[model samples]
Target chain A: MSIIKAVHLRKRFIVKKKEPGLKGALKGIFAPKKIIINALDDVSFSMKKGEIIGLIGPNGAGKSTTIKILTGILQPLSGEVEVMGLNPQKKRAEVVSRIGVVFGQRSQLYWDIRLGESFELFRRIYRIPDEEYNANLELMDSLLGIRRLIDIPVRQLSLGQRMRGEIVSAVLHSPDILFLDEPTIGLDIQAKRNIRKFIREINQKKKTTIILTTHDLGDVQELCPRLVVINKGKIIEDGALDAIVHRLAPERILQIDTDKVKKDFTYPHCKMIKCEENKMWISFNRENVSASKLIAALSAEVRINDLQVKEPDIEDAIEQIYGEG
Target chain B: MRCAVQSWFEYPLEMLCWIIFIPLYSFGGLLLLKVISTQFSEIGGWTFHGLAFFYGLGIVTHGLHVIFFFAVWHTNYMVLNGEFDRILLYPMNPFFMFIIQSFNIAGYIDITPGIIIFTYACLKLNLDWNAVAILKLIAVLIGGTLIRTGIFMIAGAIGFFRDTRNAVTNFMVDFLAYNTTAFPLNIYPYGIQVILTFLIPVGFINTYPAQDFMGMDNTFSIPINLSLCTLLVGIAFFLLAYGFFRFGLKHYKSTGS
Candidate 1:
């Protein structure tokens, strides 16, 4: 059974039509106009109990809107949404207790208080049992090293540290599902790796269903097994990571670095894409041309010093999907 | 609340200014009172000490409103800045969270002075201190604070519908209610007194209850008992304000990512 479901969700916003210049501003105050913006149009998707689905989209693609509706922070103009067998709209408080949400662009921590104090506040708000709260704290400490930073006030922490603190506060209640919106944004390599590891550990240990929305392809590549690509308030494609990648960009690239000048060589199964003084690039469909067989054919013609095989990455596949739309 | 207090105290200069200004402002009110009483024993059939009691109620509740409902005043800013989105995601009641988050201790500076002045007024006036009087005082304080909170909430909720900030919030809370509540309501014309008594109900803060306690004539001929009417008006306005807030949340379109 799906843990989270959104079907035919539609939402529209009435934005004021602001005119330009001082005269226009005065005119707006006297007689303003408004236009309707379709924030989400026929957006639909479903996720299983323990799957981590990366929801990727271009800016203004309704990615955040979908998360907002599913999390009950927003009410769709028309749709059906269920999180953990409860309609989020009607049962917001109950459903929210069963889920955790983190927005990387916004921190939920209390700015004036220490990290530990924020957690304690959440503890009382959620009314989490003592054992469960402490255990979750220990788990978060192991995964994100939350203990060392507990004494520090939120405003004093760096962006990376604050993001980690945000994640800890979100999950301290052991929510069955977690929604992370760009959780690894604006982080260094080490911080990103640590966050990714923490997410993976949580999912594995507790079977937590995670729906991550991110523009950073690295986050998608590292954490999400399933991909739900959205564009212009529509779901373009949804499936396993490799399946989407293969369907969008079927060909892989093979580069050969030889000792001396190399003549452009082509195999019947593979197409030669580029040739330099000592390197040659070939593109071939993985389904038809086995890497071993292609390498054997290339070696017969030239002395290869080094070879590298490159599979199509999530970024290229997502870009191609977005481009098509 | 503790955290908010600590953050304010972080700047010594600001704290010093607050400490000094609180008393200075109270003394200004006393000076006005002294000037008026020196010329005449009473302005509107009320002694200086009696008028001070009314002034104390308004000032103390204003201080409480600032301490407890500060978030309501800033709700517009939060909505415009998208900080309110944080409040909506929490599992608990968002209104409760907003109230708790707004608890500020700096208001204690203003409240402390009001309490000191109120005690002095009661002693100087030799007012009755029976259980009934104590009960009436508690009821008025709660009702008055609720009225202030309702007005502030209504003001802040306007931001949820429009992108612009309105000046009515400042006019109502700062000038309209604050200035009117400190003086005897009877000093104004009958029409104005009626509006304050029945329509906006700012009179419930100190005017009607103070009149009832001091055995004076109330401005409005309320159908129900004065004490009950005061409490009910406070509650009714508060609930209406909360309902308006819920309505506003339905249209709360959070700003940029």
Candidate 2:
């Protein structure tokens, strides 16, 4: 059964148009002009229980608006939203208990207290019993390697370490659905990899439906199978990540490292993106010239030291969808 | 609940700072009282010891709000920072978690001193701390604090709908302080007094309790009775605020900044 469903969901905000200066500030108090903001428009989607879907979008692309509506934190102006067969707005307290959410760039874990303190607060708040609490703590420690960082105050942990703690904190209640928004915003490569492993492991073992919204395409590549793309208050695309990637760009970039120091290297079929000496990156349409053909063309001019072919990654695909610079 | 309080007092330096800060405030308040007490024998014939009870009552509750609800002051900041979203995902009441999470133990500094002053005033007057008097003190102190916090919760809930909590919150504090600490409601004309007792209930903070201590007539406590009625009305207001907050949550657009 689909655990989350939304149809034609819409929302708008009236923000006061503020003007600068003393006179403007005074005038604003009396006569304020409001700008109509259509944050969400005619959106529709659904998620089955235990499915991990990645929601990707650019800045001001209505990613948060959708998440808020689904989680019952927000009410749609005109639309329908149902989570677990109940209207979220009407049953926020009931729906909220079943869903876990994490907003990145903000630490929910207490800043002064140790990570364990925040964990205990959750345990008592959720009315979690002793046995389940200890078992979950042990499980999280094993899964996220959080045993070392337990006693350390949140102010001390690195961004990556804090995020690992955030994920475990979200799932401590054993919620059926986990919503993580930009969970790896500012993390090192190793930290990102560690989080990716957890996201996968949690999904596989618990069948916990996950909705991940992230700027990091690498996260989507490694973890999410389904993709939901939003742009300018509308759903631009939603499907398999492969479909979006292939649909956007279907060409491979070939870089050929030549042994000879050749300055001028140009070809009609394949344009040299960079031709400084022997190392040159060649770009060709996949339909026009295959990787083998490009290799043959390169071997004719200079001895090929090393050859690497790279397909358009999810980053390029997403950028193309958004037309972002 | 005890665990929450334990976590709150985890900062020792903070506790010490509050302890010192309260005495500083008390000195200032005492100076004000000493100077003002000379000019004004009473607000409606109430004495220095009588006014001290009112002053101590306000500070004690203020202490409670400061220690327990320092974070409540930042309801807008928390929402803007996307901190409330953290509490929402939990399998518990977000409001309850936030109240507990934002607690500071330093309130006892001012509160303890205020109680001591109140005790001194009672002893100076040679008033009874007998069973009935003790019960009245507890009722006035605890109930008064709860009412103070409940009003703040209502105000804090307002921030969930609005993006910024500007002078509106300050306005509440200023307006309430003026009405409660400055004078008694009976001194004012009938219409103004009714507005205070019925509409806003600021009079409950001091005037009615002072009357109870002086053994004044029951009219002083009309405001207190109305405030007590908040047991039903306050929840309704809170639910309205909660509904409004949940509605506002849909439009919550977290800035990348």
Candidate 3:
């Protein structure tokens, strides 16, 4: 089922422009220039239940704005958004109650209080029943090993621990949909692995639908099967991760280290992009030339010492989209 | 509210300092009133005890306002920092959540000296303490707090449209609330008195209610029970301010992260 839908979402902000120097400051006090920023323009997408979709984009590409609109923290100038068959803007309280959100740059937990205390406060705010709250807390503790960090003040906890606490706080009420905005923006590898495991566990155990917006391609590669690539306030590409990679970045790099230089060496279905001394870099479409075939051709021309095949990743695919945009 | 109090208590030294300093601050104000009383037997037709009563009443209302509605003062900061976005994301009523999240236990320190001064003034005046009178005092405190909070809320709501950085709220608290409500309104010219009573309504917070308590005749020519008007005006003004705040919410352009 389509659990979330947005149609032609448009949002704009009026920003004040102040010129440089003292005279400009004085003039700004009198009459400042105003500029309009179209934060989101004609952005539309839909998500099905129990699916993990990555919303990836460059900085200031309206990723956060789209998440805010979906969560009803923002109102679009023109659009229709429906979450769980209800208009999010009109039924904000109801919609918010059914959805959980985590903004990695911002925190919902009280900084001066214990992590457990903050969770208790959220429990009261979300009105979660004591039984369900306890159950969820236990599940989170088991999955993330958060029991040790619960007594520490949020300000005192390490970023990774605090982020685990944040995720637990968000899901204490058992929301059906979860929005994670840059959830792994700053974390060590172990911490990031723990969070990803927890997220996968939650989705598998509860079938929670998740919308993840992030710049971390590793996060997208591991967690999201579907991807929505946005740039300059527009949805440029949306499909399965494999499909996007195939369409945008189908070329693989072949690095070959040869014993001797071959000035006139050439091959079909591949181009040598770089050559220096006895080393060469070849670019080839994966569909047109297999790594073995290219290796065979290079060996026939020159004695090969070492060779390596580099596959294109999600980063390359997203860069391809951003470059076109 | 529990979390707010818990966090406040976490700072032992700061909490101790605030506890000690609040009563000392109230005592300093009382000393000023004492000096003024010694200089003039009656200023603006009110004796030293009547003035003490008025001052104590104002302090109590101020304490309550600080305790319950102090978060309104930070609306500008919250809007600028995008912290207001989290408040909106909550399922609860954002205004109620904002107020509750900032429930300050330090305000109880302010109330301690206020109650002592109010009790001292009552004893000096030989005022009859009845159930109705006690209820009236509670009602007056609530009304006065609502008035103070409503005015500040209006000022705070302006943050949604412009980045005032709380200049307007500071002005209102300093000039309208402190300068006027802390003294007998009758000391001002008749025009200023009318403005305080009807236009800005700071007079209704303390001066008008104190007039009713002291059984003094209404200074203004307007035909209205000034005491009864306090609660009504407070409710009406608070509702209007909340409506304005809601209007601002509709136009809230949340700051970028």
Candidate 4:
């Protein structure tokens, strides 16, 4: 079942046209010019219950605008948004209650207060039940080890620790849908892994529907099963992660190390990508020729000592998708 | 409010500076008034004590405004910085949370001098300590605060229309509203009085109440009972301000990235 849906969503921003220099500043004061910018142009997408979907796009491509509209922080110029069976604009409070959002660049916690105090304030704000709140806290503690950092002031905590606390607070109320915008924007590898693990555990234990927007392709590759690629305020592509990769980069690379060197060889549906001495790299479309087939064909020609297969990296695939879009 | 208090204790020196600086600043204003009164024993047909009484009323109301409406004062900054987005995400009326979060503890510091000065002026004036007078004073103070905050809310509502660094709202609250409360309204021309009393209603915050307390001839054509005028106009202005805020919120174009 679709937990969130948006139809023909559109938003425009009126930006003042400031001219350069002192003369322009004076002219601007007298006769300010305004240009209308289409922040979101007929964007449309939907997410199923408990599905993790990545909303990927280039900067200024309306990814954050779309997220703001869905979260009800922004009202689109024209559109219909339904989150958890309620119109987000018309029933904002109700819609917000069912969702949690975290902006990685900004924190919602009080900077001077302890992390636990912030959680308690949120608990009162959300009116979460004591038992459920405690259970969720325990779950967060186990998943992110947040209890150890709870006593420290928010400002004193490291970026990674603060982000963990942010994630924990966002979910303390057991929101059914979580909107994570660049949740791992500045985290180190270890922090990123911990956050990814936390995200997976929450989705598994609570069936939380998550909509993640980030430039980090690793996040999309590791977490999102589905992808909604947007560019220029429009949905460019929407499908499975592997399908996107397959559609963008269909060929897989196979590296072979042989005991004996051989002449440059090619077979039907297989091309020699590179050859250096006893080692050769071959590329072949998986649909036309399986890895086994290509390997057997290469093995017959060269005395194979070692073999390795490399699937296309998601980074390259996403870059291709973005570049094409 | 609790969060603000907790944060206050986090830096003892800054908090102490904040608490001390408010009354110290007000003391400078007091010194200015003294210099003025020393030269001319009376201004606007009222004695020095009478004018000081009005000043006290204005200070207390200003402090109350700060306490209750700090969020409205900061709406422009919040909107500009995109902090207002978080308020919308909470599962409650954003205005309610804004007001609750804005109950600044340091605002009480501003009230200390106002209370002390007002009490001293009243004692000097030898006003009858009747129950009715005391009750009326309480009503006037509450109403004055409402008027002050209503003006603030009206100014803050402008944030919804544009991204501002607070030049407009500051002009409205700090210069127009706050300055008008500092002295007798009768000294100003009739047109200015109308603007202060009917338009921004800064005169209602203190001047009208002072006139009634001193039993002086009110400048306005309409006769006003102190308590009734304050209660009626205070509630009316506050509702209008809140209504304006809600109307402005419909046009809230958040600083979307």
Candidate 3 lDDT, tens digit per residue, A97-207? 999999999999999989999988888889999999999999998999889998899999999988998899889999999999998988999999998998899999999
Q: Quote model 1's TM-score.
A: 0.92
C-alpha displacement of B203 in model 3, angstroms?
A: 0.7
lDDT, candidate 2, B154-238, per-residue tens = 5665665666654678577646744455556677887877767666565666667767777776453444443244333434434
**Model 4 residue A242 distance off true place after TM-score fit, in angstroms:** 1.4
Provide the DockQ value for model 2.
0.35
**Lowest lDDT 10-residue stretch of candidate 1 chain B:** B164-173
Using all chains and alpha carbons, the TM-scores for the candidates as numbered come to 0.92, 0.83, 0.96, 0.93
Candidate 1 lDDT over A1-325, as tens digits, reads 8998889999998877879999989988898888988888898888888889999999988889899889888889998998998988778889998899999999888887788988998898899999999999999888999999999989999999999999999999999999999999999999999999999999999999999999889999999888898888888888999999998998899998987735657677788888888888899998888999999987888898999999898777887998997
Candidate 3 CAPRI category: medium
How would you encode candidate 4's per-residue C-alpha lDDT over A1-325 as one tens digit per residue? 6899999999998999999999999998899999988989898888889999998888888888898899988888998888988988789999888899998888899999999999999999999999999999998888999999999999999999999999998999999999998899989999999999988888988999999999888898899999998888888889998888898898889988987766668788888878787788888888899888777877888889999999987777877877876
lDDT per residue for candidate 2 within A1-325, as digits (tens), equals: 7899999999886778888999888888899878998888899999999899999888778888788778876678999999989887777778877778888867777776788888887787777788977887788888889889989988799898899888888888888889898988988999989888888988888888999999998899988889999988899899999988888877678887777845566656777677766677877777777788668866888899998998888888987888942
Give the TM-score of chain B in candidate 3: 0.95
lDDT of 3 at A76: 96
Q: Is candidate 2 or candidate 4 better by lDDT?
A: 4
The lDDT, on a scale of 0 to 1, for candidate 1 is 0.85
* Full ranking by lDDT: 3, 4, 1, 2
Docking class of 2: acceptable
**Candidate 1: regions farther than 4 A off:** A256-308, B5-12, B37-41, B166-168
Which tens-of-lDDT digit does each residue in B103-177 have in candidate 4?
A: 787788888899888888898898997999888888888898888888878887888887667877687578876
Least accurate 10 contiguous residues by lDDT in model 4 chain A: A258-267
Error of 4 at A301 (Å): 6.8
